[model samples]
Target: MSQISRGLENVFIKTTALTYIDGDNGILRYGGFDIDDLVEHTSFEEVIHLMLYGDLPTKVQLQRLKTSLNEAYEIPQQVIDTIYSLPRESDAIGMMETAFSALSSIYGEMWNKNTNKETAIKLIAKASTVTANVLRAKEGKKPVIPESSDSFARSFLSASFARTPTNDEVKAMDAALILYADHEVPASTTAALVTSSTLSDMYSCVVAALAALKGPLHGGAAEEAFKQFLEIGEPERTEEWFKKKILEEKSRLMGFGHRVYKTYDPRAKIFKRYAQKLSERSNEARKYFEIALKVEELGIEKFAEKHIYPNTDFFSGVVFYSLGFPVYMFTSLFALSRTLGWTAHVIEYVEDQHRLIRPRALYIGPLKREVIPIELRG
Candidate 1:
């Protein structure tokens, strides 16, 4: 019998140059650049270039990529009509998947060495537009036209909220997008790579990724983690609630632990700062931040021996909530940021190897037996 690796744990299917993770040290990097350095020095647009094209872009190259992205930001009118026609109560990420799948009508093509890169750029560029419009349609609001003059972050924010964002808000949004642009190969990335392995178009690959990301264990964790803060209500009640819901009842704490990182998620560290800074602007945000701090304090104290620390989802919801996004839209925002990573991985995998990802299962059921007659089976 073959050894069974449930969930394909610790499986290394192939090598990737996109993102690197040192789980033991809680270090993350993109295209050989340290995550901390990238977040501090580079905008989301620059990170997009780095992930797709390899090295950091020069001033001229960055400008050109930005131009290409801005040009592709406007999704087709048919896609917009599809977005408007969906039920208002539809899941945001589900709507995003549908929108990307709809892109197949126009952009879908068989694997082509010449045109694949251009298709990747278009998918990444339009992800934000698709996400923002999905949110608008959910609220029965018309789509906001993309402005080529606006930066990537500004473009999404202005359209989503129907208002121009302040410079500080734009900076925060950009950093958040940069942090989530890529992370080695999580489940969603794996799903995407699997689809791309079969030589599917980039849009179809992203749709597969989105389907995987819509699950609670993956992309929905941020929304669930933030709900814990809301449930705790007051900062002073955190201890009692932690004792009742976590310690005594043994309920799982959503954002406290990670599968890979033994220490604090480096992305979470960056998000904590943004959460703190943005929390100052809103009374509601300040209250949630306070509760989150208390929960983290207690969580670390209890789980330090286990090496289960906060992951990226810990404070990300707080930052989004602070920015006035609804709780349900959390994962959709994640999808928006992660589209770059998904497409980057898809392009790399398809262009490099293009092998189908099929693994054998260890069957443990009883050996084949003769089927009994229907009357005798009972």
Candidate 2:
């Protein structure tokens, strides 16, 4: 047998044209456009169109896509009720998973052998609605339905926070969403793809992705990274905290490494700029940014030799926090942005002569062991 690749590290599954990553060189591109260029030049809606349709939208196409997404933002009443019924202490991402599962029942017609762009748009739009309402229900606030006039990023932020956001805030949030829109195939995307390979409905595939993303090592990393900044408290204390917590105590840091990126994550670079820009407007945000910078400096000093540097989760928490998101809602925000990628991959895989993503496990236990009766086994 070939040497087992634990965790399937560096394993190639299938081809995709959606997103590309040159991890060794710290490059990311959606379709064929570089992420940095996209973040600077495109709206979240535009990136969604690019990912789903395989090209940037013209003015008319972009408006139609926006209208479709805006119209789809109102989730089913039953899904909202389901969100409210969950315990207040329920994990936010988990609540989203449950909500999407409930959404699948209402859109039962979507359960077919093949998925399409319309289904992808609906799931992408409703992901934000479900996530916003989940956070609102947790805070004992009523859900806010988005107006059709609102832009995609604005709709999510307004609905999530129950207030209108400033233009700068909307721009920052849009960039954040675009930066997180897709990343080739991470754990969550792979989870979605695997479920899609089984000819599952899009909603069920999203639920599966959410389940995988809830782990600390995956989508949950941003929340954990924010907690670290809060724990550090003061910028001045970062070095001592790093020494005690990370050096002497040998504690693992949450946000500084990636499985693929050998240098700084390209998304992290974009997020860091946003974090710095947003930090200037809020004292609390500034403090977190300062502490994050210090931590990044110290971390790079220690680990740069090995090519481990800040991943997307590093400064992303600070950006989310600055944008008025609670720490708990970080991963759900990830799910919202990633919905496009998940559905895109699903559509691509199913359309490209789909195959079940089943792999074999090497058996190591006693070969050909004979089963004994319960009475004799003892």
Candidate 3:
């Protein structure tokens, strides 16, 4: 007899060199390098290179990669026209899926086996550029072009906001991107991989990933966390909010507990610092950060006994708020960064051992019975 693993909990799927996680100890690594080290010493572009190529790039290699990303950044104006045609109050995640599917329709014929890398670079750059355009279209503003001269975060912010981001704002955006770049076989990435396992194109895989990310269990934790902070309204109200939500009602603290991490999420630890540093400069951001700190403390005190702890989503929204993004854009930014990992994994899957990812399902329903004549059947 076979037993079902509900939700595929603790299932091992395939091997990867992209990322590593030790959830029990709250560790996350990309390409064998500690996340703490990456956050301190590397840029988001470097992290992207590491996830894609499995090694840190030399200065020449880095510059070449940047040139490739820059060169592939342009999208046809027809694509922008589609974005403008959508309803302005539309969901960003759905808009992303629709956009990528449209992109696949536009570029589908261009992708063959050999051009996957070029396609990957194109999709990676297009993810952010198109997302910014979607936001601009919603606002009835002209789409701003990304500047290859600036870093990816700076370029993305400038395109979305139509103004140059401050150096510090760029730094925070950079950190958020790196932190969210990949999480080993996350549902969104796996959705992309599952699509790729059948030899689908990269844009199709991206559409799959965006669809997965739109699920509540995957994408909106950080956004929900931010909403809770605003509901708490101030630092002084943090304890009351925490108690009413977590202790009194036995409800979750949204971003506090993780299915994977038994200890504090290492990414959260890093983001808390970013939130603090950034909060010092922005009064609006500072208010949310204050509530986040109190929530973290009270959450640990109340829930750590159960090995529940804050995950990466805990403070990422505070950082995003500091960088001046609207709340709806939070998960779109996640899809943008994770598209790097999605494209990378799809490439790896297509290049290696091949098989359909079909799994068996357990059946539990009515037992079969002999059929009677139609007139006699009840």
Candidate 4:
């Protein structure tokens, strides 16, 4: 029999306006909006609406959508308190994963088909709240539920930091959110679509996506990037540390490589500027940027053929670092943005007649082996 590719890692399985991944070229777009344009001109909520509904909303539509999202933002105090009860040092991604798992416990009775759309909207809306509250709770601050009038992006930044952000901060973070909103049906998004394909509850689908996003190589990269920064300390030490790292780690440079883009990730390009702007506010900004550029240049020179281009993670840490976000909250923030794409994909999957996503897997293990007693057979 001929070998068949099922998961189709390098093949397109479906067409979508939700996002475009030109991995070979290292470009990403959502619903016709380039990642760079969206980051420069739109809010996270606006981007979310675009992905879901296929166009940037008109003023009235944007208002109504924002209103609905804000309305759904008031999560139960029980949820907030549950997050509070987790250990302060607990991983933010793990907390989000657990909190989402527990969201079902509170809304278990509502877990049916009749409420799927409503539930998806609610999950999309409350995602920012969940992530923001977890960050606050980790710091022993009372989590702020969204105020009725706040934009989703503003409310999330305020709730997480316990103060409203400056316009510049909002723009930077909104860019970060929009940039991370989707990445062309990554593993986590695929997990979400597969779950939704089963007609599983939307909340369950989001929960499953969270599980996939918690992996070390995906959303976890930003956190790892930050950790490497801390290990490298000041800017002057960067060269020494990076050199030692390449020698000892061999093929890995933490945030320096991309799996797809051969040149540079466009998303990373935008954040590189934002991170630079943000660093100007601090004495350490120049040093950090220099270190980042050095890493990128070195990685390109050493591993360009391997597609180890500077990725989104390359500058993501610098942005979060300049903004005062804790390293561990990196993936939680990613989850909050990606909730939009997850729901959009779920909605898209629901429109299909088939509710299954069965795919063939290459089997390399013995096909007809019988069970044997370990000690006796040996």
The estimated TM-scores of all candidates read 0.97, 0.97, 0.95, 0.90
Question: Candidates ranked by lDDT, best first?
Answer: 2, 1, 3, 4
lDDT of candidate 3 over 200-249, digit per residue (tens): 77798899999998865777788888888989998999888777877889
What is residue 113's positional error in candidate 2, in angstroms?
Answer: 9.2
Per-model RMSD to reference: 1.4, 1.5, 1.8, 2.7
lDDT of 2 by residue, 1-378 (tens): 577887778998878888889989998999999998998898999999998889999999999999999888888788899999999999999899889889887774544434488888988888888988988999999977666654899888888887889998999999989988888788998998899888888888889999999999999999998899999999999999999998999887889888899999999999999999998989999999999999999999998998889999999999999998889999998888999888888888888758998888888988887789999987
**TM match of model 2 to true structure:** 0.97
- How far residue 296's Cα lies from its native spot in candidate 2, in Å, is 0.1
By lDDT, the better pick of 2 and 3 is 2
Q: Give the Å error, residue 263, model 2.
A: 0.3
Whole-model Cα lDDT per candidate? 0.88, 0.88, 0.83, 0.77
Stretches of model 2 off by over 4 angstroms after superposition: 110-115
**Per-residue alpha-carbon lDDT of model 4 for 51-157, expressed as tens digits?**
76778888887887787787898777778888888999998877887777777666633334465545666787778788988888888887787665446767777
**Tens digits of per-residue lDDT for model 1, 1-378:** 548777777888778998899989989999888888998898898888888778888999888988998898888899999989899999899899889999976888888878876777788778878988988998888887667754799888888998989988898899999998888788999999998888878899899999999887888999999999999999999999999999999988888777778998999999999999999999999999999999999999999899989889899999999888999899999999999998888888888867899878767799898989999987
1 against 3, candidate with superior TM-score: 1
